[model samples]
Target: MLYDRIGVGYAHGRRTDPRWLAPIVAALGDARTVLDVGAGTGSYEPLDRTVVAVEPSAEMIRQRPPGAAPVLRAVAEALPVRSGAVDAVLALLTVHHWPDWRLGLAELRRVAPLRVVLAYDTRRHADFWLVREYVPEIARLELSRPSAEQIAEELGADEVVPLPVPWDFADGVFPAHWRRPRAYLDERVRRSCSALAQAPPAAVERGMARLRADLDSGRWEREHADLLAAPEWDAGFRLLVSRR
Candidate 1:
């Protein structure tokens, strides 16, 4: 419920970047009827597909565009539709938020007539730049979020298509921010992440100060120069496309 209110203007700040989208859209692959589970403000949906969104957050639901897919107010643990109804199920960056992960996965298994697509960062990768130094509080906050391997099991996914994507300020929401330190310093971008949302404000303040000093002293650049150009880091962001 708390994440429902994450940042006042996310359509832009946390807008979906195309680098990740190209592959995600590919994974969704020709499914005419798609179910976007935990669809946040209808961010990653493909405009061409017929999408039915299920989200429990009132705040997030209201942000969906007027012409965007139809939305249903429901928790992931229990879906309103009958089994094997849709061509695919798509869940992105959201399994960690589920109160009952297995229950939600069970529902996912029950639905989706043929295939399912999912994206979530691995908790182990939370050690990326800001998460480890400027946002230690966020690291601790994310510890409870389930791992990628766990999600693979829950989806009963025959295979999870592997796509390693990273995010820098130049890119979208991703861990490659490990490469671009400046973006994490931005208030709007930081607001999109859950760990930052859960951290104590004072702790975040202190962390940011240290991060600022590192940037000012040229330490950050010297340390991660190569990363700045490196296209991707394995931040545990995995995509699972399942077939029924």
Candidate 2:
């Protein structure tokens, strides 16, 4: 499915979570040159580095910060940079949208000198209240996105470090809001989410209604009260710091 208006609102909701940022940043491993593939609105591009970004979306490119990389209107499968020009390559929450997976991975491998960092959610955790009760279609949408293991192997890494980062919606961010459950009810927050942001009107209505009912009936609390006190959830957001 094509990206919807969420691309416009993405900067608001899909922020650069610091916990997630640490791993992606550290994965670059002292690299000075970087390429942000599918750099949506320059949300996660790092400063103080020689960086370039590739994106085909015009609106997204327009949203780039004043100092962000000189974005080229290019697809990930076909990059404009010469081989080995960048020391690091990063793609956040975007690989899933690529129509061709292997070609994109091949492109990254050809250009990146050392590291390729990524953050993705592939597992459709039906157990997640947001997924289970509210928007199960997202789980189905994720099936098109390649798995992290596949990405690791594509980058030719013999070892992949899978770090578990959990977000509790109640923490007021990340995993914190999940424990609160009410965050998902907000239309603004939902608009920030690409999955629901792209959903059909009927599907969004149905999903939100179910989620509201669950929250009101205390079913959400009863089922996940134990998690409410807990700090975070293993949301399948991971860092794949692939090294040559």
Candidate 3:
């Protein structure tokens, strides 16, 4: 559906950033079987685990690299998985995309004793330079979605950890280029982010035009010199780990 339309070249831009992998794997604990819900291109699936992926987008499924976990063409709201079939359930940066995230969370709980979710906190994202200065529309778009706190509360999370984006984060998700404004100018990079891809064309074009002008005039660098020197930034990503 949405991904099939916008996820054409997803794999090229959304590779697993090892920085993120460590925490996810650690949160998974001793889980031998993991169900990766909305496993886009299977980016963060653990190689050592018995992982089964669930995705609704054929285009995204097609992009899964060779030797990736077996996938079922299913939506998160109604996972085709048995009750307590897996040791853990991992939903990474995908809950917002679900039509009914509550249902998805319920399914995750039903399928495993442990649930790990990576969610976005719009309040924190509002402070990100890109959203603060250029694309306020992205913040508006995220408002209707459940926040990281809400997800944590719904799942009764045992821990809510902040996930900061490294200066050179390998993944091309939104806010990955907080210090590297030039990356947003690239059409490929913008298209890889769902917010940018789904954002109104007029708004995106207007923001990009302003961002380009700011870069050309060195205003961006001058304003964010401190951020340029910083190693990483909290772009509102949070990891919610729950145990039954």
Candidate 4:
């Protein structure tokens, strides 16, 4: 599994952020049962609901905390549950990793009356400060991601809401610590972000060196000072909701 090799200890950095949960909880909309596809480390599973998780990576499954929902070793393309078996299905930041995302969406639609997906637009991510300034290779990485529009069209989504990342976002997902540039220097933080891990190691080292130099000289702070005052940033994250 991709995560098993590069994603060990992911839970240490990638815990759920409360600010990102309200929208997800609301989208659930009275659903008694939820199927969390690609459920990694059980970060976003609502404690108030009956939740079942489907995950392919054994490493990720092993990382789930003591009281997390039951997880099945399965891929999204072929869920073990029956058609309409759950009230809602949630796929968060995991669709782009699917080997066959369209087929996976069909499986989610087959098993639930409501589907909610958290996705990103590659173009928007390219404009982010980290990618634009430090890692140009991230532009290529973003290009490979399944676009927000593509996912919305596939699911026939009824709502696509913007999900701007908070400056102090607790989740260790990409670009979450936009205001805290130093967080990027931490190995654990980068380990949880696939974009950093996937980039060539030498290129990553070069980017990090440049970033460190910029921070020491106050060049980064000077360039992005406006971001310090902003409460949140739009990094192209979107929530796609579909109800049938």
Q: Between prediction 2 and prediction 4, which has the larger TM-score?
A: 4
TM-scores of all predicted structures? 0.90, 0.87, 0.97, 0.98
Query: All candidates' lDDT scores?
Result: 0.74, 0.69, 0.91, 0.92
| Backbone clash count, each prediction separately | 2, 11, 0, 0
For model 4, residues 26-83, the per-residue Cα lDDT tens digits are 9899999999999999888999999999999999998999989999999999999999
Give the TM-score ranking, best first.
4, 3, 1, 2
Q: To one decimal, what is the Cα RMSD in angstroms of model 4 from the true structure?
A: 0.9
The lDDT-based order of candidates, best leading, equals 4, 3, 1, 2
Candidate 3, 187-229: lDDT as tens digits: 8898889988988889889999999999999999999999989
By summed lDDT, the worst window of 10 consecutive residues in model 1 runs over 167-176
RMSD, one per candidate, in order: 2.1, 2.8, 1.0, 0.9
Candidate 1, RMSD to the unseen true structure = 2.1
The regions of model 4 sitting more than 4 angstroms off are none
**Count of backbone collisions in candidate 2:** 11
Candidate 1 residue-wise lDDT at 196: 72
